[model samples]
Target: MGRRSDHSPDELRELLVLSGHALMGERGFAKFSAREAARRAGYSVGTIYNVFGGLDSYLIAINSRTFRQWGAWLEAALIDAPSDRAGRIEALVRAYFGFAQNNQNVWMAIYDHRIDRSIEIASEDDAAREGLTSIVDREVASTLGLNDNDARRLVRSLIATVHGHCALWLTGSYALLEEKDPAGQAVDRVLEILTHHLTPSES
Candidate 1:
């Protein structure tokens, strides 16, 4: 007879999610494996699908959880930061850098993940993906005195620039920046430009 399943579906699912998180946090998405996740969770490879449908589905769930956790970290970072707009934006940038450095594997997994075009992304998953951006969007709107659309556009631009710079740091392109600390310098320069451009001028 087959070995009996010891855990309920909910318990098993939770176990698999945690195991997947830890595994991906070490190996990153490129080398991730549902089989490895199941093995680590003390379940058979097939049992993972019995819970999550497939590897992609399982990863989507994992990525969603990761984003929510990251949002919490960013939120915590902002709490004691200065109340001024530039200071807050600077805090946000520094928080991103810290998160990326501290959780390199999981942080990269967020961007490294690629979903099938035919797959329907759950609304919660999309919202989770936007968690960090929503924080930036709010501050950008208030600081720049921008309307919703303009603030959103500016947020996207800022994310692209920061992400690109961070990517260079991750890829060891330090020489590309004319500074000792490429990532910090990039963030500082961008924040400086944003503050200068957005500050109200005296008549």
Candidate 2:
């Protein structure tokens, strides 16, 4: 017979994930440990393994949850944003910067951790990852009136541009700029440049 656990498997997994998330939020990916998570959860190390298989799996779970939570936050922030194409796009970009700043450790961890290829993806996990992409796609499609293919391409470019600006801002690349919010100014400048390329029909 299998060893009995005080908490059900599902409950134990959630507890482990929650604890792991707290640890990562404090120390980020570099310092997070399954042992610490187990301690936080008041479960034995063996129990964490039983719940999540290993630390990598637990980390992946945390990353997955992070994506879902981030997506929801972005969605809520966009709700009250202006419906005009340019306004909405700018809002989305600003929201991205805020999210990155507020959750620097957790947000970065999404890209910091590398998952094994052999690990099977759950449907919800895939959906969580796609949620952010879909938001951008929807906005791009509506704003540019482009087909799905073109909108996807544009979304990818827009995301790259936003990420580049944010990354540069994080590295203090815009420190000397005259603008009060260098990152915001960078975002506006990049958007202006990209918008300039749009022909009448494309917009």
Candidate 3:
């Protein structure tokens, strides 16, 4: 029974996060307060404070979960790719866009400033930068022939391209991938361009 009660805190926290997502998705973060989230979660405002320091912490928790989910999806996509490097890049790009479409609110929360600023949430910019560096260091630089600095630069470029394309797609600025199936084609085009730029010439 103790363990059952012990699990309640975590379960309640998850409920709060889910409620936060919905509220934030509907009204934007600034309009959504702790009381609102607590009400949505069917809990007391004090309960919310018990779980999270404030709305900022709650939003951070939600965004962190989103990042972890996206990262895991990308990692699996990379692992499931064909042996070729280009194939891996293509898989990564496809997975990213798929995640964007499937998790639009979360994607927007991470990308769009207006939405993010509402919650007073700090950008995940540094975390993303560090993550990009790790991917380049472990996967690209070490596995390939590139030095650390070059690998970091290349990874930065790739991240920029992905974010740019994803931002356009998420904001409906580009109608090219508005539909479900068009995402693969869009990713393929981006992968082709990246491959052409990154693949070394035959001696």
Tell me, by lDDT, which candidate is best. 1
TM-score-wise, the better of 1 and 2 is: 1
In terms of lDDT, the poorest run of 10 residues in model 1 is 194-203
Ranking by lDDT: 1, 2, 3
> Alpha carbon lDDT of residue 36, candidate 3?
81
Global lDDT scores for all candidate models: 0.78, 0.76, 0.65
lDDT tens digits, residues 120-176, model 3? 444653474366336534554444445667667766776666677677767777554
- Alpha carbon lDDT of residue 127, candidate 3? 74
Provide the lDDT at 142 for model 2: 59
lDDT per residue for candidate 2 within 1-203, as digits (tens), equals 12355667777778778888888888888887778778888867887777777767777789889888888788987998998767777788888888878988888788778888988767777888888888887766556645668767777877877787776665456543343575577568757855755668764
Candidate 2: count of backbone clashes, pairs at least 3 residues apart or interchain: 0
Pairs clashing in candidate 1?
Answer: none
RMSD of each: 2.8, 3.3, 5.2
Clashing pairs in 3: none
> How many residue pairs clash in each candidate at the backbone level?
0, 0, 0
Best by TM-score: 1
Backbone clash total for model 3 is 0
Could you give the candidate ranking by TM-score, starting with the highest? Answer: 1, 2, 3
Residue pairs of candidate 2 with colliding backbone atoms: none
Per-residue lDDT of candidate 1, residues 162-195 (tens digit):
8877767765675554545656776677776686
The runs of at least 3 residues in candidate 2 whose Cα sits more than 4 Å from the true structure, single-residue gaps closed, are 1-5, 171-182, 193-203
Candidate no. 1 TM-score = 0.86
